[model samples]
Target chain A: MSDFLMFSLVPMTVAIVICMSCALLGNFLVLRRQSLIGDAISHVALPGIVASFLLTGTLASSAMMLGAGVSALFTVAMIELIRRLGRVENSAAMGVVFTSLFALGVLMLEWNEVGTVHLDVEHALYGNLESLIWFEGTSLAALVDPRALSDLPPQLARVAWMGALVVAFVVAFRRSLVLASFDADFAASVGARPTLVGLLLVVMVAVAAIAAFEAVGAIIVIAMFICPAAAARLMTDRLASQVALSQLIAVASAVLGYVLAGYGPGWMGLGVSLSAAGMIATLSGGFLLLACLFGPHRHRREALST
Target chain B: MEAWWRALIFDAGYNTSLVTLGAMLLGGGAGMIGSFVLLRKRSLVSDAISHATLPGLALAFILMALVFGDGRWMPGLLVGAGLSAAVGLWAVQAISHRTRLGEDAAIGAVLSTFFGLGVVLLTVIQSMAVSGQAGLTGYLVGSTAGMLAAEAQLIALCSLLLAAGIFVMRRDFLMVCFDPVFASTNGVRVQRVDMLLMLLLLAVVVIGLRITGLILIVALTIIPPVTGRFWTDRPLRVVALAALLGALAGYLGVTLSSVREGLPTGPLVVLACFVLFLVSFLLSPRRGILATLMAHQRFKRRVHLRQGLLAMARDEAIFDDLTMRVLRRQGFIRRDGVATPSGWAAARDAEHEERLWALYRQYYPEESAQLDHRGLLPIERVLSPDTIMVLENRLMMGRGAHP
Candidate 1:
C-alpha cells in the first residue's frame, strides 16, 4: 500500500501542481480571445522536440524548452502573417497556421529516423512520469551519502522550477496582461505596447506548454489549459476570482482523477490513466453546465424567461 | 513521379473510388451552402457541431455492440452524429443567450466540452473491445481507404437532392441573405428560411465528416467560400465559384494524397483551397490588391491632367506655350498645350463649354471680364461676339444649375 502511494499517489501530487499552473495561465489566455492558442502551440511543439533531439543528441529539458519556444512563437507569427498579408479572418488564419504546422511536424517526425527522437516525441505526447523520476546529480549523490540532505527527483525539481517561474511571471506582470487582454486599444492609448504584452503572454504559454508536455501529451494539454479557465469563467465575473477559481478547480480535478484512476483499477482490473488532463476538461465542462443551469447571471434568467 | 501519378488516378479500389466521389459531391454541395454561411458569419458553426457529435458516435457504437451486434452500425453512427449535432447547435444558442460570455466564447465552450465528453466516452468504449465495433475508431481520424459503395451512393444522392433544393430556392435564399427583414415584410417566412439553412448546414457537416474527420471538417465548409469571395462580388457567381473550387480541391487533394504515402487528404484539400485564395488575391480584377493599386494610380493621373488643362485655360498669355508643354509631357496635349488646329478648334469649342464655364465660375466667378482681358477667352469670343451669345446658348442647354 505504501509502495502504491509512493509510486502512484505521489506522482499525482506532482500532476496537481502542474495542473494548477496550467489553469492559472490559461485563465488570461481564454479571456484574451485566444482560448485555442494552447492547442495550437502544443501541436506545433512536436517538430521543435524532433529538431532539438537532432541538434543535441539528447532529450534534455533545456533543448526541448528552446525548441518549443521557437515553434510556439512561429505559430503566433504565422497567424499574424496570414491575417496581415492574406486578409484572412482571425479564425481562418488560426486554422491555417496550426494545421499547417501540425502537418509539418508529423512529416518531420516521420522523416527523422532516430529511435531516441521517436521516444522523445512519444514523451512529448503522453508524458513518462516513471522515467521522469530518475535523474543523475545531487539527488543521486544524496542517496549515496547518508549525511547529505535528501533531494527530490530531478523530474519533480524541474516541475517545481517551471511552476515557480509561471507563478512569478503571472504575479509580476498581472496588471499589464490584464490591461492588454481586456482592452488592447485602451492599453495602447495609455502608452502600453500591446504587442510586447502579447508576445510575453505567448512566451508564458510556450513555457507552460514545455513544462506540461512531459506529464500530459499534446492532445490532452489543451484540455488542461482551456478547461479550468472556461469552467472558472462560468462561475465568476471578476478576472482575479476567475484565475483563482480556475487554479482551484484544476488542482482538485487532478487529485480526484489521479485517485480514481489509481484506486478504481485495483478494485476492478480496469487500468486507466484517469487521464488527469481529460478529467480536468470533463469537470470544467460539468461546471460550466452547472453554471448555465443554476448561476445567478442575468443572461440565464433572460433566456429562461424567454 | 509520372508512374505514381498514373497509379493514383487509374487505380480502381472500390473504397478509393467511392470515398472520392462521395466526398466530392457531398463536400461540394456543402461548400455551396457554406457560401451563405460565410456571408452570415456563422462559418464556424460546422466546427462546433462536428466536435459535439463525438460522444454520440461512441455511445451508439457501444449500444450497437451490446444490444444488437455490430455488423450494421452505419445507421447508428449517422443517427448519433445527427442528433448530437442538432443538440449541440441548440446548446450553443442556449449558452450564447443565457450568458454574457459572447458568441465565440459560447462556441468554444460547447465545442471543447462536448468533445471532452466524447473523449471520455471513447476511452470507456475502447477499454471494452467488442468485435465489429473495432472499426469505429477509424472514423475519428478518417480512413477513406475503407468506404463502401452503398455509403458513396447515399452521400451522392443526398448531396444531389440537396443541391437541387438549393437551386429551386435560390431566389428565396437571396432575399433572405440580402435582407431578411424585407423578406419577412414581403411574406417570405424568415423563420422557415433560417431553419432550412441550418438544417442544410447540419447535413453538410455530417456528410463531410466521413472524408475530413470531425476535427477538420469546418475547413471544407469555410475555405471554399472564403476563396470564392476574392473572385466575385455577385452572390450567384460567388456560390458557383465556391462550389467549383471545392470540387476541384477535393479531387486534387485525394489524387495527391494517393501519390504521396501518408498525407491526410482532408488537410491537403484545404491547402489546395488556400492556393486558390492566394492566386485570386494576387490576380482577381476588381478586388485584388494589385488591380486596386493600378486603378488608383490611373485615377490620380487623370485628376492631375484635368487640373493642368484647367490651369492653362485660365491664363491666355501662357496658354499656347503651356498647352504645348503640357501636351508634350502628357502626350495628349501636343507640345503646344493647344489642341493643334485641333487644339485651336478644341479651344474654340471650349469657349462655350458649360463645364469650362462652371470651372471658370468656381475659380473666378466675378472675373469674366478679367478672363477676357487676360486672353483666356477663345479668339472666337473676340472675332465673333456671337460666341458670348453661344455661351448663353450653352448655359440654357445646361438647364439645371447647382441651385
Candidate 2:
C-alpha cells in the first residue's frame, strides 16, 4: 500500500485534477459547438512548447505555457481566417491549420537535435506522467508530513490551480455562457457579447490544455476535454447538473483508469502495466459510449421536447 | 545546388527517383480526393480516419509477426489500415447520426479514443516477442527515410487507383455534396456514395501513412484543396488545379528535402503544400487576397467619388479626405478643392442622375427594389435606352416641382 501510495498516488491525483479542469472546459465547448477546438489547440500547443524550448533553452513550465497559449490563440485565428478567407467549412479550416502547425512543430523538433532532450514527439504526445514520482513522500506516513505534502509533484499544484481557474471562470460567467451558447444573436441583443465570451472560453481551454498536457499527454487532453462532458451533456438538460455530472465522470474515469492501467494486466497474468493516459482515455470513451446508448436525453432537442 | 536541380527532375539516383515518383503521385491523388472531401464539408473526416489507422496498423503488425515473423509487409498493413479507417468512419457517422453529438464532437471523440486504444495495444506489442517492433511508431508522424521499393510501388499503385476512383465518381460526388436529398431522390444512393468517397480517402490515407504519417497526412488532404479553392470558382477546375498543385508540392518537397539533407520528407511535403497554399491564397487571380483587397479599394474609391460628386452637386464642401483625394486624383477638382471644368460637368451629371433616379423610383415604385441597389454606375449601365429616355423626360418635367 505504501509502495502504491508513493509510486502512483501523486500521478493519479494530477491526472484526476487535469481531467476535472478539462471536463469543465469541455462542457462549454460541447455546448457551444466547438468541441474539436480542444483537439486543435492540443495539436498546435506542440509547436508552441517546442518554440519556447528553442527560444529560452530551458524547460520552465511558465515559459512553456506562454508558448502554448500563443500557439493556441494563433490556431484559433488561423482557423477563423481560413474559414472566412478560404471559404472552407469550420472543421476543414480547423483541419488545415492544426495539421499544418503540428507538422511545423514536428519539423522544428526534428530540424534541431531536440530528439535527445526530454522534448521529443513521444513525450509531447504521451507526456511525462509515469516519471512524475513524488520522491519526498517515501512512506505512507509521509503523506501526513507537511514537507512531503509541500514537495508533492509540481504538476499536481499546477493542475489544481488550473481546475480552480476554469471552475471560477465558468461560475462567474455561467449565465452569459449558457445564454450565448443557446442563442448567439439573442444573447447579443441582450448585451451578452457572445463573441467575447466565446474568445474567453477558448483562452480558458488553452490554459487547461497546457496545464494537463505535460501530465496526461495530448491524446488524453483531447479525450478528457470531450468525452466526459459530452457524456454528461446527454445525461441532463440543465447546465449546472451537467457540469457537476461531468466532473464526477471525469474524476471517476481518471481514478478508475489509473488503477486499471496500473493493476489490471497484473491481475490478468499479462504481467505488464498499460499506459495510464491511454487507459483514462479508453475509459472515458467507454463512459461516453454507455451514455450514448442509455442516457435519457440522447436524442436531439426537438425530439426530446416535442 | 546542382545536385538539387538534378534531384528536382528525378535525375538524383535510383532510390531518390522512386521515392519522388511515389510521393508526387500520392500528393496528386490526395489533392484530387481532398477537393471532393472539402466540397462535401467533411475534410476533417480524414483526420479521424487517419488517426484510427493506428490500431489497425498495430494489429496487423502483431498478427503478421505471429504468422510470418515479419510484420512489415506493406500490403497487409495497408489493408488493415483501410479496414480500421472504414470502421472509424462508421463510428463517427453512427455517433453524429444516432446520438445528439455534433459531427465535430464525434470526430474528436473517435480520433482521440481510438488513438489512445491504439497506444494501449502498442504497449502490448512492446511486451511481445516481436523482433523489430521498434519501427511501428513511425506510422504516427511517418518516416519516409526508410521506405522500401516495394512499399513505394504499393503507394504508387494505390494512388493511381484512388485517382481513378475519384474521377469515376466525380458526378456522384457533386450531386451528393451539393444536394444530398436531391441525389437520393434521383436514386443516387447518397449513403453508399458517401461511404465510397470516404473509402477512397482512407485508401489514399493508408497509402500516405507510409509517406506523411497519420498526423500530417491530413495536411496533404486539407491544404491542397483549400489552395485549389483559391484559384477558381468552378468545382471541376478546383479539383484539377489542386491535383496539379499537390503534384508540384510532392515533387518540390521531395527534391528540396533531398537537397537539404537533414529535414524529414513528411514535413517538407507539408511545408511545401503550405507554401503553395499561401502563395495561392495571397496571389491567385480569382480569389487571391490581393485581388480581394484591390476590389475593396476600387469599391471604396467608387463610393468616395460618388458621394463627393453628390456633395459637390449639392454645393457642399467635400471635407472627407478620401473623397477629396478621389476627386483630385480623377481631375474632378483642383488641388485647392475648386471644381475644374470636368468637375463641374461630373457634378452636373451626378445631379441629373439623382433627379432621374428619383423620378424612376417615384414612377416605377414596383421596380424600385431592383433600382434601389444602383451603385456607382450611371443610369445608362442599368436601364435600357427607352427607360432612360422616359426617366430623363420625367426628370426634366419634375424639375420645377423639385425646385
- Candidate 1 chain A worst ten-residue window by lDDT: A131-140
- Which number leads on DockQ? 2
Q: How far does residue B18 in candidate 2 sit from its true spot (Å)? A: 1.9
What digit string (tens of lDDT, one per residue) describes model 1 on residues B1-403? 6633653564646556666666677667867887887776676667678778777887888788788767336667878888888888888778777665555656666676677667666666656657765466445534455566777677667777877777677677778888999999999998789778878888877766666667666767777777787777899888888888877777666666556554555656666666776677678786666776787676655444444455445544344443345445655455434444444444445443535466445545676545643333344554346645565665675665533
Candidate 2 per-residue lDDT, tens place, A117-189, comes to 8888877887767777888777878978998898888888888899899989988998899999999999999
Model 2: lDDT of residue B115: 87
User: What is the iRMS for every candidate structure?
Assistant: 3.4, 1.5
Fnat per candidate, as a fraction, reads 0.17, 0.73
Name the lDDT value of residue B287 in candidate 2: 75
TM-score of chain A of 2: 0.95
The Cα error of candidate 2 at residue B30, in Å, is 1.4
Model 2: CA > 4 A from native: A301-306, B260-262, B370-374, B400-403
Could you tell me the lDDT of residue A233 within candidate 1? 79
For model 2, how does the per-residue alpha-carbon lDDT over B205-319 read when each residue is reduced to its tens digit?
Answer: 8899977888889888888988988878898888888888888888887887777655677787888899888888789777777888898898889889989999999999877
